[model samples]
Target: MKQDANEFSSFAETIASLGSLTKLESAMSAAIKSSRVPAKETRKMLKCMSIQEAGNTALFQFMRDLFEKVGVGQLVLIRNDIFRYDFAIDNSPVCKLYPHVKGKKTCYITAESLSQFFTKDLGLPGTAEEIACQNAGDNRCEFAVSLQPLAVYQLALDQLDKTIIGSVIDGAGPDKISESLEMSRDEIIFRMNILKRYKILDDDYQITEIGETYHKYGEGMGGDEEEFQPPWKDMAVISNAISASTSFAEAFTEAASQEPLWDVEEKDIVNLAEQAKKSKSFAELLSKQVKSDMEE
Candidate 1:
C-alpha cells in the first residue's frame, strides 16, 4: 500500500541521513520490531524439530513460509548447508522503496530478518548479508546467512545434551551414561545420535574436537543457555503487539507512531497513521478487507 510505502520511505529517509554504516545498522535493527512476531509464530510449526534436524531443511522451509505469511514476498532458496544458507527474494518490499537510490545493497531488512529467523526463531546462530541487490543493479535481492559451528552447537545443545557429551568426552559408553543420568538407554542413544549429527561425535561414538570444545563451553562454557526476549520486553513498547491481527506494517506503524518518544516530532508517523486509515490512500488495507470478508 502507499501508506506502508510512505511510512517506510520516512524511515528510510531518516536512517539514510546517518553515516553509511550507522544507516545500515539502524535499518537492520529496525526490522526486528516488524519481523519478530511472524517469525515467532511460524517457528512453532517446527517446534519439535531440533537444530540437527532443521538446520538446512526445515529452517529454510520455515523462512519460506514465513515471508509469504508476512506478505514480504516469496523466498527462493538457492543453497542449504550446515555453514551457510543462500536465499533470494525476487520481490523485496524494502528494495522497491528506494526507486531512485542506487549502487548499494538495500535489502538490509530482508537480510537481518533472515538472521533473526535463524538465531531467534530456529535456534541457529548466524548473520545474514545481502550479497546482491536489485537496487544495486542485480536482478534480485540475494542473501547469505553464515553460521558459526561453535555458537550453533552452544545454543543447540541442552543441559542433558552437554552431560551426554561430557560423558562421551570421559570415554563413557551409552549404557554407562544412560545409567548415570537415570535415563533410558534408548533416550541416551537418541541424544548421542543428535550429537553425532552435529559432527561432535565420530562413527564409533567417540567425542571429536568440536565435542570437546562444546563440553567445555557449550552451556555458558558449560553453564547455561541464553534466550532472546521479545520486542515488548526489550523495546518498551505496548504489550499487546502479540495479537494475531497485528501485521508487520502495523507494528512498524505503531512504533513510528510513538513520535513523542523521540527528541523531535516525526510528522511522517502521523501521516502514516492517517494514510493507513483512509481507503483512498491505503490500497493494501482495502485488499485486506476484501480478503477478510471472503474468509468470513
Candidate 2:
C-alpha cells in the first residue's frame, strides 16, 4: 500500500514538472513573438545594399530586392518610376496574422510601415497605394510604388518644360520647336513664358546665362553664391558630354573617356544610362538634346 502511495506521489511530481515545462515553453514563445528587436531570420532578410546616392530607378529596384529578400513578395515594375508589389504567395506582414479577417479595405499597417521607411530611412517622401489586397478576397495583393513626391509633379516644372528649353537653344521658333519636340504650339509658349519668369529665357526664347546654368545643374544653380550646390557641379565637362551624346551608351563612353574631369565612377554612369533607358520620355528628350548639339 505504501509503495503504491509513493508511486502516486512520483506520478504527481512528474505531472507537475510537465506543467512547468509547458508553461516555460509558452513563456518563451510569447517572448519571441513580442520581441522588439529583429530576429535572425529578419536580419538576414534585411541585408539590403546601400542606396544613398542611387537615382529613382536604382532606389526602386533596391527596395524591391530588399522586400523580396525579406520574403515580402514578387515585385513588378509598372513604369519607369512605379512598381506593383504583390504579396500573395507568402502573405505579407500586413496580412500574415490577419489572414482570414475580413472587412478591411486597405493594408494600413503595410502602407504606414513603408511610408516611414521611405521618408525616414531613404530621405524620400513617397506613397504606397494598396489597390488590391488578398485579405479583401482578391487573388493577389498589390501596391503601387512611386519614388517621386506628388508635390514635385504639382509645383515644379517637369521634364517636358526643361526639354523645351533645350530644344530652343538654337533660336528655333515656337513652330519649329513644337514640331521637333512633338508638343503643341500652346505648350511651347506656356513653358517658354515660365522660363522667361525665371529669367532663363529672353523674349526671343533664347537660353540666357542663368538658363544655361539651370540646364546643367537644375535648381541647385539658382541660389546665392554662398548657398549650397551639389559637388557634381564642378564636373561640367562630363555633364555636357552626357547631355550631348546621341545615345545613353555613347554618353557613358564619353563620360568614361573624360574620367579626369570628374570622379564619377563607371557604375554611376551605367546607372544613369539605365535610368534614361527606363523612361521613354527621358530617352526622347535626350535625343532632342543630341539633335540640338549637332545643330550647334
- Candidate 1 — which residues are off by over 4 angstroms? 1-71, 76-83, 98-105, 115-126, 132-140, 178-186, 217-296
Per-model TM-score, in order, reads 0.50, 0.33
What lDDT is obtained when candidate 1 is compared to the true structure?
0.58
lDDT at position 127, candidate 2: 70
Worst 10 residues of 2 by lDDT: 38-47
Summarize candidate 2's per-residue lDDT along 147-169 as a digit string, tens digits. Answer: 55332222234556667767767
Candidate 1 residue-wise lDDT, 1-296, digit = tens: 44434433454443332222232333333434443433333233222234434434543554565565444568887765546767888967766555545676766657766787667645567799999998888998899989876655544566677778878878899999989999999988877876786778898999998777766655564243334554333332322222233444344555555655455346644453333324221335447557756987
Clashing pairs in 1: 217-221, 219-222, 219-223
Pairs that clash in candidate 2:
none
Tell me the lDDT of candidate 2.
Answer: 0.45
Number of clashes in every candidate structure?
A: 3, 0
